[model samples]
Target chain A: MSKDKWNDEEIGHWLKSVPKPEDNRSRDDILARLKADPRLRDKQPSRSRKWIPAGVAAAALLAAGILIPSLMDGGGEVSVSDSASESADDAAQTTSESFQSGRSIEQNSAASDEEMSLRSDQSVMEKGLMGAAVYPEAMEGFVPFRIGLVHEATVVPVTFLIPESVVAEDFGSVSPGDAELYNRYASQIDEEALGFDDYHPYQGTVSTDKGGVTLVLSGDHPYDTASASITTFAESVQETFRNEENVLVRDESGAPAEFDQVGALPEIATEPEGVYFAYEKNDGTTVLAPDRRFDPAHAAEAIELMKSRTTDLFEPLIPAEADLIVELPAEGDRMTIRFEEPFDFSRMDDQDAARMIDGIALTAAQYHLRVRLQNAVNPPAGYQLEDVLPLPAGPNGIILSLPG
Target chain B: MDESVFHRIYEEYHQDVYRFLIYLTKDRMLSEDLLHEVYVRVLKSFGNFQGKSSERTWLFSIARNVAFDHFRRSSVRRKRTDESFDWETEQPADRGLTPEEAAVHGDDMDRLFKVLDDCTEDQRMVLIMRFLQELSIAETAEVLGWTEAKVKTTQHRAVKKARELLEGMDGWGGGGR
Candidate 1:
């Protein structure tokens, strides 16, 4: 009864007195309603239907990568008497040649420059090929054409290829005007390359305005590639549509993205390049190597990859047993690395600590990121980094350095 | 969910769900409508019930979301109307209470509901789940997607506010019934 404070017992007693309505509906009425209720039907199966288009788009893109090169080579016109099997063989041959040229350039570049080269030999291979004017006439307006380097591997080079026929009907479904544009672009493409091919390059709609050519990369094209690949793809697209003063690239969501040229793209690093993992040299000095499989663009992902015990090829400098929690700032490019428990460096010598710092700093630097160590006791001399410490130029500073 | 299993669940928890919705919305017809919707959603998502929480807590959580959705829809409707609507002034269904029955129980019960309606939605939910439904702090937290500490804090605040509201009532100054 006290007004100042009411306990749970008093509150319960008062709430128990609140009146409620009696259920007047018959069991039959409830059952009937339940049977008719649409939500009660199996809806989970329908949820997966949304992903079908994406799967189709991915398949179409893969097919385009194989078929587009040959189609472009033949000038987009196929002979009516040519068997489907023969056309398939030609496409397979073109794909092989393109891949071979890419590999040869990569091998030549690696041999020429011992340092890791930012620009792969794919650019040289592209230069050898005819310009974007080689885009077949069948694909001009009907298909979305994007020419860029694809980053499928650390050292391997692949060209960006689009398969536009997969979603041409979807574009044409939008309006008659879009159909007209598709025809105009289709006619404008280099039709002499391949005859009326089933697959055309370009996945989304392409339109040119007073500003420049805008290519909306629609459906499932290029989103699965690395950040570097997306940038390369955009650059290639810009190169192909070079006459336009500006080339605006939009993702499937219709949001304008500059990849990494002017702004950051959404974390599209399905496979990013230049991931660093710690390895030890013969002299017991720890070194870092760019791990191709595990490219971590952020500090937390990098720390997780680091925590995975290394194989014989690489060694971990940070104590494998130490649980590190990393917090990345939302607005700025700073990362804070905190240990689950206070990290004791008294057991570690200064050189070992310095090696760990180098490994951490170089891993962050791969993403153009920075790190701040929290609750690190006895960090190495001149390396007690507090907040927002700039990453070292390279990892394993004593034994190895990054290429300038 | 299998039809037989779904029927059994509906039979077991429908009343409790109906009561909770009534407490939340105060309108019996709206509560009944939302109760049906809650069960419909439960049937659709029953396979995803990972058994991390008790069936009762999960059902109450669904009920809470359905009630909030109703509130959102009604608020949008209310925006179009010229006249203002006051929750305190809206009378709940009498359920055929006689003049004599009303005279005996209506005043204090009405006042209690009015005070409850005055509380913030989060505070009201915490108080109702913790006290009226006799859910534990952990259960309340799970249902509301909140921390146990947050549940305790909101419960404390809600009780304090209810006491203040009761004390302000005419001729009801710190005295038991």
Candidate 2:
């Protein structure tokens, strides 16, 4: 079986020997999936049945093979025009193609599917960014502005993509830096609209120089009301400007600002530690937070712990219905998650599934590991199933204030 | 749209496209996802598929685009994060199977499969389309959005590369020891 070179005939023989695996789904199963795809729901015949409004929390549901056509409002790797799935892939596309023409289901007798490419199921919407995390694959032509927004007790890091068009129109040609992001749009956010309490447009000028970020607070700033208030402010600052090593808080005179409880603040190190779990509040704000009492021995433990509630406050990222088998490589940074067969990911709420995937990736990052998901019904966008995927740029993805 | 027409077109071509995607992505789950996408797009734009080309060829082209789009997005993301990772130049561990997998698929098949994974994307695609899926040079060109000459050239190189690597393997019996 050894030779300096094999012949073409032999190569063809071997190539022909390569196995052809059959899709396990029946035609009925496939048709059901196609019909249930909220992305294609308009093309479906109107029947006296429940139809999930496209992208109504259905962003990442197109790995859809089993769910009866429900609703779609979230984005995953599955894009649905611009108004379709709020997927990272959609966000990465040229910023003008919106796919909200489902109402007409126009007779494009002359238009070919090639016209839209295969991007129908994967566009970024202004609505819900399905899982709200920037997989490494998101934002190619766009710049990502990642910042931590304060939500009462937690610091939530979210990403906004600034399209090139906006960059060109607003800043001439060059993309602006992350430091400028907070200054430009921090005050513009209606924190309550984004499910966070009113916090931004901090009562100060934040400048990042070689000495680190300098917070020149206006005298009337109420950050010194109590110890808890100062702590929240410090944590928010730390989370927001995690890139800088030292943060200095000063009064308008540029001297160290004093609080009644903590006195003058020292030069702060910008570091946020520990992993996060999806926590839902009584008011319905579901953000990622770390349990004050729960700490794991390692990343594997953290990932396992994240599957279920660590406390009453924290909800699991991975759903209870998925009886997934996770295999951590004894060495190396790749984790393998094998799902039990007959699992239809589209059946779960898109937001839940997305958070679960992001939560797993974020947890794996605690040990510098990337997850390689296996045997998923429809693994959402922001994941490359064959490759070990890195964690999303940040959690709670938002496209707020695409600065122009 | 009548479901029967879709069923017929699907019955004929879904397996071939699925096989092609499996060969291209080398992951069953991913292939399934891409397969769904292909049909989803196909069904949505089915009215416009005017038989300008044969249904098989059109379907193959759609399938190729679906696969290509997936790869392009993935590679684009990688390039952003890891400066050194260039999709055009990256040799991959796409289908490297474990001992259990090799035993299940047979050592020779697994070896060939793994070796094929290392081939350049163009060459690998040409070889799979030309030989395994049995698309002609013309159809392969159409699917790849390339010319027939490029298809022939890539098919030749893909086969040569695979053969050259296999000659050095221990149990490959194709070259007539």
* Best-fitting candidate, scored by lDDT: 2
DockQ of 1: 0.14
Per-residue C-alpha lDDT of model 2 across residues A1-404, encoded as one tens digit per residue? 34555688877877787666667878888788667554344432322122122322112212111110112222222334443233333432311122222211011111221221223234333234333445554444445666666554355665655445555676675555555767865665544434454577678898876777788889988676533346557767766776677688898887898887557875555644446677653234465654323335666676666666423335777766667777878987787877776556677665566667767776676566788777776644323356666655556554332322
Model-by-model DockQ, in order? 0.14, 0.21
Tell me the TM-score of candidate 1's A chain: 0.32
CA lDDT of every candidate:
0.49, 0.58
DockQ-based CAPRI category assigned to the predicted complex of candidate 1: incorrect
State the C-alpha RMSD over the true interface residues for candidate 2, after superposing those residues.
Answer: 13.6
